[model samples]
Structure formats: C-alpha cells, structure tokens
Target: MAELTGRIALVTGGGRGIGRSVALSLASAGADVAVTARSPKELDETAAAIRALGRRAEAIVCDVSERTQVDAMVARVKTALGDPLILVNNAGIAASAKLTDTTDEMWDRMLRVNASGAFYCTRAVLPLMLAAKWGRIVNMASVAGRAGAPYIAAYTASKHALLGLTRAVAAEVASRGITVNAVCPGYVDTEMTDASAANIVKRTGRTEEDARKILEGFSPQGRLMTAPEVAAMTTYLCSDVARGINGQGIVLDGGALQS
Candidate 1:
C-alpha cells in the first residue's frame, strides 16, 4: 500500500462504480488523486472521499471523448498535483442493441467514449510519464471483449479495440519502465448492469432471479463481481511488485467462460 506514496494518479470516470472504487483505493494507499467525470457532483463526491482518506484530490470535469476537455484535464491535474505517474483509464460507455438495430450513432458513441477516450487521456499523460521513466496504466475492459455477448455489439467491439490498444501501447513503452494493461471484469452490480438486467427480465418475461442467473451463467461462480473486487486487481497491478506484468489483460470474471 505504501508503494504508491507520493505518486500522482489520475482516474477517469471516477464518479461511480469501479472507477470510484479505484480512486479511493489509490488515495488510501497514499497517492494524490485527480478524479474526472462528466458529472461534477460525482466527481466532487469522489474527491471528498479521497480527501477523507487524508490525500490530495482534484475533481476535474472532463469528457474523455472530447480531446479539448481531456487536454485541459491533464493540464489542470498537473497544475494542481503533479505529473501523473499512475493513470486508470476507467471511463467507458455501453449501449445494448442487436447488430441490425445498432445505429451508427450508438457505434460512434461507444468508439468515442470507450476506445478513443482512453487513447486521448493516455496520450495526454505520456509526456510526463516518459520524463519520469516510470508509470502504471490500467484500462477497464470487460468480459464481453473476450467473449462476445448479444445485444451489445458496440460495447463489445469497443472493448475489443481497447484491449488491442492496451497491448500495443504496453509493447511500445515496455522498455521505458511503463506498464500498460487491462482488467476485464465480468458482470458487476453497477447501474449499467442493473439496467441491462431489468431489460432482460422485461424482454424475456422471466423472474428477476432467473434473469440474474442467466447473466451468472457466464461465470463459474454464478454471481456478479463487486466493484471493490475489480479495484483490488487494479491496485495490485499498479503496485511496484507488478512491474513486469505488462500488456496483460487480467480477467475479473470469477471464472466466467473460463478461458
């Protein structure tokens, strides 16, 4: 935990869910945190939690999909804290639609927010990390990226592309003491999943328990993973002991689809 003491970290989409948990974890471990989200309220709440842990926190309003805002966010974080050495590319979007029903707007939005967004933020922070010669980047991916799911073509494809980007970047900077990796989680009890589950129950006319079990069928544990559980894996990946683990996509599936 003390390994991150004095480090500057940036977490995108830190308003809630796994992103929020990751931000708190970093702050608890002694890192200064910069939290970015479209919603200022969520960002403020995250910042408050970080400060409660006795660490510096910056609540930056940023839409990672927007290059201008992302750039400004980087500058603000650096100005307020320092050059971020740890980055959690946790911002992502999800839309559920079949292949034929998936509109171009949905596809574009997913690519922009889930894929391009990660690229923009990471690119913005690279200079400082390169100068320091040490960094940790953890991208939030999903099991859908590894195992395709129905009614979420855009989200699945975006995550698939994100994993590719994560691997490619990890290779390019592996020699420079920078680690870029992805953590792919299975179904988590987040608002997004709750909505998806509700839709499943409505569409299939099944009991809530049955609908949940259907989702659980993807995991051997037959349950959804927790946000803190996913955060733990990410926190460990950012640790000094995990310096050699690069270009790896660690699955947080609870044995989902057991590859």
Candidate 2:
C-alpha cells in the first residue's frame, strides 16, 4: 500500500508553485487532497490535477490571511475530505525593499499571511489531529527565516516568526503523535521569483537574466531550485517514516545557509 493511502492533506497557496507541487506530490503518494488559494481558477486546476492522479480532491477559494476565511476553509475541508491529517502551510507573499521604504502595510501583510495564517489553520486542525493522535504539519519557510539579508527585513522577520511557530508547536505536540516542521528553501524557480527578478530589473536597471542570476548565485548550485525538489522533501516529511523528524527546519539551498 502507498504510505499515505489513508491520509487527507490540505495545502494552502495550492493554486501554483510549490504549494501546487506539494499538493500533487501528496496525492501521488495516495493522500486525498484539498487545495486552497485566493484564485478560484487556479485552485480548480490544481484540484483537477489531483483528481487525475486518482485521488479525491477539493478546491477551496480562501485568503489565508483572514481568520474568518481560514476557519471557513478548514470547515469546508473537513466536510469534504474528512479531517486533514497532513497540513502544508505554503501560502505566502514576498517583496523586497530597503528598510526605509518598507511600508507598515507591507510588514503587516507579511506577518498576517506568512505567520498568522499558519497559526489560524494549525489551531483549527489541531483538535482533529489530537483526537487521532497522528498529524503532520509542514510550513514552507525560507532561508530568510534562518539568517537576515538586506532589503527584505519585513519578509525575513515574518519567516523568522513562522519558524518560531513551527518549533514551538512541534515541542508542544512532540508526545502527541504530531510533527511540525519547516522547509527552508532558497530562490525557487516560480512566478514569485520571476516577479522578484522583474522588480530587480525595474529598480537596478539590470537585465532580467542578470537579475535571475543574482538570485541563483545565492546557492552553490548556481541555479534556482525546482518546485518538485521542494515538494519531494515535503512529501517525505508527511509520511510515516518521518514521524521522528519534528520541530526542525530542513534547508534545501544546495549547501547554502549551513546551520
């Protein structure tokens, strides 16, 4: 039997990028999946892809930053796919700006989606996991969570907060058959990174290739990591074999940010 044949997974930001990859990966591993994002079309596409893999799927339109939406999303997941024993908190936004230019709105937005969104979803699902005495939670963090970099102070701080949440929740549930962890990846080859590169081109007057190369250079691998690579790691963490691995941030930046 497949490792997660009886599991139900909920992936936030599952419309595209890493979230979509992780959702599909879990489905491939035999978990019925529920995908949530603000974009209904994208969410529907992702859900259809999961169904094509022969797993049950649900597409939920939700803005994770809002507590009401998060609560409703979880309710819908439970009604549709049973309790989500596996939760991938992958919804997030990224922006780069000098400290002086980072507005209060930007800071609040980062924290709300990247950190509090995870909190609300986790809280909503904890009861089910505790009742079952088995759960897996993977937070899609970044290298910024471990170390600070210039020009992304707000984003960095929000990620750090996420890591803090991961570790604390993991500790709280260590003896309860639930695991909470974070996957800290460097620049991923996604639309988000493309936007970052575009921003660089607009701000620094560099060619798009040069802007992308700058991001790729952050890792020793000299390339942007693929979404599947991150998805593979996330899928493993949600499996039974990974039960012992809890409360840790697994970094996948090709030898960068060693910690």
Task: Write the residue-wise lDDT of candidate 2 on 186-258 in tens digits.
Answer: 9999999999999999999999999999989999999999999999999999998999999999999999888
TM-score against truth, every candidate: 0.97, 0.98
By TM-score, the best candidate is: 2
Best by lDDT: 2
Question: What is residue 35's positional error in candidate 1, in angstroms?
Answer: 0.6
* lDDT (Cα, 0-100) at 16 in candidate 2: 100
- TM-score of model number 1: 0.97
Error of 1 at 16 (Å): 0.5
